[model samples]
Target: MIVTISDNNKNKTIEIKEKKLISTILSESGFSFSMPCGGKHICGKCKVFAKGNLSEPSLKEQSLLQHESKSDIRFACMTYVLGDTEIKLINKETEILTDGYFSQYDLNPSGINYGFAVDIGTTTVAVYGYDLKEGILMCKDSFLNPQSIYGTDVISRIQSSIDGNSKELQNVISDKIQKSILRLCDEYQININLVDNIVITGNTTMLYLLLNKNVRPLASAPFLIDDFLGRDVTASQCGFTHLNNANIYLPRTMSSFIGSDITCSVLAARDLIDDSKSTLLVDIGTNGEMTLFHNNQMLCCSTAAGPAFEGVGITMGVMAESGAINKVYLENNNIMYTTIKDKKPIGICGSGLVDSLAVFLSLGYIDESGYINIDKGEYITEYNGKHAISISDSGNSITQADVRAAQLAKAAICAGIYSLLNEVSLKPSDVDRLIIAGGFGSYIDVKNAAIIRMIPEELATKSIVVGNAAGAGASMILLSEKCRIENEETAKKAEIVDLSTSPYFMEKFVDCIMF
Candidate 1:
């Protein structure tokens, strides 16, 4: 069977061996479709238009499309193909951030002249090439992780792994990383063979999915990791023979949820380790992992913030890509905003989401009690027959459900922050510095974040956006043995706090749901 994806006056066709759901076929075709609810038919983001013989939509599909009259539109994950069909993709071309790599650590060249520092994030994968001989960063690149087709968050991927899709997940990540390495080498006009080492960092679940390890332990309560420590392997060991002799060094993971990304982040952010003052380090991705440093002791916790921040669950959420509204404010009684590249607005990203909510609250369009004055707001617009607030000139808007998702995500992160502070007998004012890491954290307006109460107001001015600390720390380990040793020691010293078992955390989480 042949399936076609038509978008922007272009069509690309791919052949399928057998009858299958459009979502499965699309995934096989290497397109990163957003399945925010892990293809459970809960999220309608994967809706596509069909033009040929196909099975009838299920009751779930009918309910999802009850308000619409177009019979051609159906959920891709729920629609099964009976014959050849042409599928019109509703989602735009995914744009990923390629820049914004920063680190405060001093460079220390090692025996390897060329190497790769990789950050295997749940939603994206970024790589940095290092010229160890000259102690400089040579090239950097990033793209959406292909494994996103299976699921956006780690738990979904873990379920897929346990369901016997581990090999496929492993292959996708491996291929992308190898291609990134080759792409870097080609861009710099260097031989791929010259790259001698690769250092890796990610959440424990991401690392497990990459290595094709058993994720059954993480699928339930008492999340146990038999061996979460970092390992040294070769390119061939992980099935990437293209880079023959490159050594793959994975940083040590802190706990089942608190992974190596936090460990690497701790290495990159020196402010978190200062003894003279207390500090908070937050890497807000799908998993909002944070660390608190005080008097040479570190405390860490992880929260399931979901994929809303990375543009996965919301109505028109997107990554920090071209055409994505990344900032929003009011100028002279008119709403003003900025996109990633000043291009046409397609959707709002994490930064824009926070900014929009903050602006709405300031303008009285939304109340501090989480009520939207939908009937009276000037920016009020209709989206899919529902009331929405416009954030772009293209009629793209945020629905009430989208705001609720943001509330849940923000609440989780905020709850984690306060819960940690409460455990240390410190208040928000006591925090000397709050370092925000990760792709979303880096691009977010700190003041906007504070206004939304996703972050504390007291630490807003003290907040610093250290772009991709995990990736930077990965580069540090790739270039210097000193960094690797120091990171290992730091991971051992850090303590993981289980928020699930804390009544105080639950109470804080409930209280933080409001604006």
Candidate 2:
């Protein structure tokens, strides 16, 4: 049961017994990998390259590997352990630099008044432990979803559930989270029975996966969700009975695609805007969901931005994990980058794409319209063509095609912002603040985000990316009753704007692509 992860002198080992699956062992040992849809195998995430007989991959793993490479890579969640094995680990490229980002709150460390707030993202789960009285976070943990074998997008996973694998997918995610709660329960030396409660926020696909509900309706139009907004339920209902009837609170939702996760983000970010102010709250992911608050009312919508921003559906793209080329900086009029974990740059993440665009613009390489001049004579060579435009030199390296993919992704977000603003009877400059949510958004530089034309240029300084706002919002509900009621009310007051039905959406997407 000895497993080793090595990529040079760096080595870490994790031990597992005969009964443990390969997925559990990896997360237990703190190795970083993504299970973006809770290990359903649908997202083709939680991918790994193993050494030894355990390396032989499943058929589903083969298809996922086909997306990344033709070689013998495997899905860790789907891969079983016949024996001990060695696997290279892929952690996040950047550590959460907790600078002046979060306002320091005084937390009471006495006794055992703690709560767990969870953000169930399609790609990963984030758990935050908070001290009740002091109202400050103590520790945080995250892991990949085990149900990724089913599919990547929610629709595909819903289809997989139709074949009787649905319950299994639900168990994968619930079990992983249950164990994470227990781990925090033990690490903080707090009795699980005494812990306050737990809160969860995620898109409809995630909520249904946790509830083990039939999601067939969500996949097809009218695409109605049985219950978009949620109610307080016992731990047993969410398969968390192991915590002695822990209470689970979920945020309200608007639609099948636009779920409570975005609502939770809006609640957390509402403070970012003041009264007599016009602002927008954007939570971008595989589903680019957003809300606009103007004149004391809220209107919302969701755009099918797809997985391109999260590093899916690209030849050489990956989640924001280690070894991803995070930045392309101009030094001495030359472009150089530092990869995640300081290793050789392999693929690029969403933030990396934003940073790449910023660097290109800062050096006058790419125009404001996001077009890279293919004229070899127009730009100086960088690192001797290690990174080039209108050319190819490395495996899965950035190309003109990749630029267009990023364009589409950014266009969807930008277009959504503009459309939402227009509906509010205002222009981009009229907004007082623009708040960005999620770890991906928080990690990206705001000025760079605007320079690349992701948001309005005039509002660059006003934009703020709140790290794990969904998780933070859920954390607030875990401790306070006022926040819980407010969360549900927010969902009801929200006007779900269906951008998919908008005739102007296609036009906006095309227009944003030009810049």
lDDT of 2 by residue, 311-354 (tens): 77554567666777666566786656666777766677777777
The CA lDDT at 90 in model 2 is 46
After superposition of all CA atoms, the RMSD between model 2 and the true structure is 5.6
lDDT of 1 by residue, 349-419 (tens): 89899999998888877887677788765799887788888874655688888888999999999999999
Report residue 515 deviation for candidate 2 (angstroms): 1.9
Please report the candidate that would top TM-score against the real structure.
1
Whole-model lDDT, model 1:
0.82
Q: Give the clashing pairs for model 1.
A: none
lDDT of 2 at 193: 75
Weakest ten-residue segment in model 1 by summed lDDT? 93-102
Model 2 ranges off by over 4 Å: 1-47, 51-113, 133-136, 361-372, 377-396
TM-score of 2: 0.80
- lDDT at 208 for candidate 2? 82
